[model samples]
Target: MNSFDSSIETYLSNLHFGHLATRSIASIADLYTFKGLVLIPVLWWMWFQHDERREWRREMVFATLFSGLAALVVGRLLTHWLPFRVRPVYNAELHLQFAGSDLNDALLSNWSSFPSDHAMLWMAVATGIFLVSRRIGVLAILYTALFICLPRAYLGFHYPTDLLVGAAVGIVIAYVMTRDAIRVRYATPALRWIERHPAPSGMLAFVLCLELVTQFDELRTLASSVVRNL
Candidate 1:
């Protein structure tokens, strides 16, 4: 077998065994689901419950949420168009073997496999949350890494490379957006627009634009090559 085929074989071996072990662990899915449900409310309590941060707390809260969503959507679409990859269950082609999951159904698989949305989204959220409060951010990332991302690989929803790349994308997006948010905090025009519009509008516009950019064949080929190298 060629190198690519060999890689797939390795993935399959790891995945089959991994799932058997994963079932034994207290479900990572449950941990992530609970975290997702409580993430926002908990963050709110952290920000406002502190009597000391009365003024700056609200601003920081808005920045973190707005920047996190923007990063997730932008990062997800940018990575999707690159090198269309077949997911695990659809391995009829025998091109690449992926981890198969018993927990999250293979039927939920979408196009492309190089970057995982869950990884990116959670990483982005954790990153933004971290920028606002070091204590909270550290906990969020720890929870995400332990529960959300590791389970994805254990269940075969994504490859190790996919998770790593998705995380890098998330971090970059979060850093960039957060930096911009900081600038906007000081800029009069930006502050005015942000106050006038809801938090979702900027993020929504970014997602639409990302969709358009990924449609071009020239850019798609460029992205495919980049991901292949990674």
Candidate 2:
């Protein structure tokens, strides 16, 4: 597995170019990896536009958001419990392909590189969305693959297997969350509460927006601090 990962990384690193076009692709790729930022607005629009299926849309939005949170939690747990894995660019021996000056070394160095949180979150949300609307779900899947997963791999942020396993975990969790029994037993009640209490829900959304802007680094730091203190 090490050899396979290294060989693929080598191939990709060799393909890196210093062209404006390549940098543009990498920039877009970085932008889309934050699934919450891009998808939340889309989900909001969908929730509002489909008046006929407003109830269903509400459920879908909640499911996707919940599943994404689950993915982040699970991914963080895996990173904590599992052996520390260095990212490709940080591996001193490996020659990683990166757009010069565009790569943020500090950001790349801070996190473990096992199961990709980005892949997991987006895949979970994509699968959850699919449960509600097939057409949009299909589009989400394509976007995840093309714009999200591939770019991460190409940019040496993750090994292909890291993405594969993260995506698989996300899909399974999302599928389970969207099950009829689960939805009836849990989601329905949660949605009812939110509907009854819009103010609190709005406040939560505002907090979430701030967290997204910071890329949840504060939350991660808080979690780490708690673990260390414990």
Candidate 3:
């Protein structure tokens, strides 16, 4: 075995072992990942579509989401490149005492363990969305902690500290992108465009398209089907 493998084995061995399962905890985690990460942010923007004070309407919200996505992409890219540590499953020397069911190749990940992409992505989005509303921001942070951070740990993908650092990176990036002047500056052109259009459905459609594209793998799988030939 290579030194890399030896290092990874040692790291995984040091991690505290817990009984891993793919049961109720995983299901609950999935729900939070979807609702908190996906639905809530969209719904929050929709609810305040008519609020003129927010300075975040169609194009602005779209831009902010794009910025959040960019932040997450960068975070994931760095995590993939840097040699941090490895998850137990990938540690060659360690015999895992409690093996959970494989989460299917569809959900399988091979990223180096440290900063979790899930935590970073959702937290970044939460930070961006929260800037428009404090209630939404607090809710976003809480959601990221419970849904993204906790689940990654419970599922054995990351250490609790990994989630913490990921969230911190996400929030810092989001804040840098959404500082007061930046928000106002970016929102101006968006506001002008909205003034010209003044319809919510168009903006909503565009945002939905972005979300769908982000989740294109899932949609593509759904589009294909199992066929039985006689």
Question: What digit string (tens of lDDT, one per residue) describes model 2 on residues 136-163?
Answer: 8898888887887877777777888889
Per-residue lDDT over 97-119 for candidate 3, one digit per residue giving the tens place of the 0 to 100 score: 21233542333344566776666
Best by lDDT: 2
What's the TM-score of each model vs. the native? 0.63, 0.84, 0.66
lDDT of 2 at 166: 91
| lDDT of model 2 at position 190 | 80
Clashing pairs in 1: none
TM-score of 1: 0.63
Model 2 RMSD in angstroms: 3.0
Ranking by TM-score: 2, 3, 1
Which pairs clash in the backbone of model 2? Answer: none
- As for lDDT, the candidate ahead, 1 or 2, is 2
Each candidate's root-mean-square deviation in Å?
8.9, 3.0, 6.4
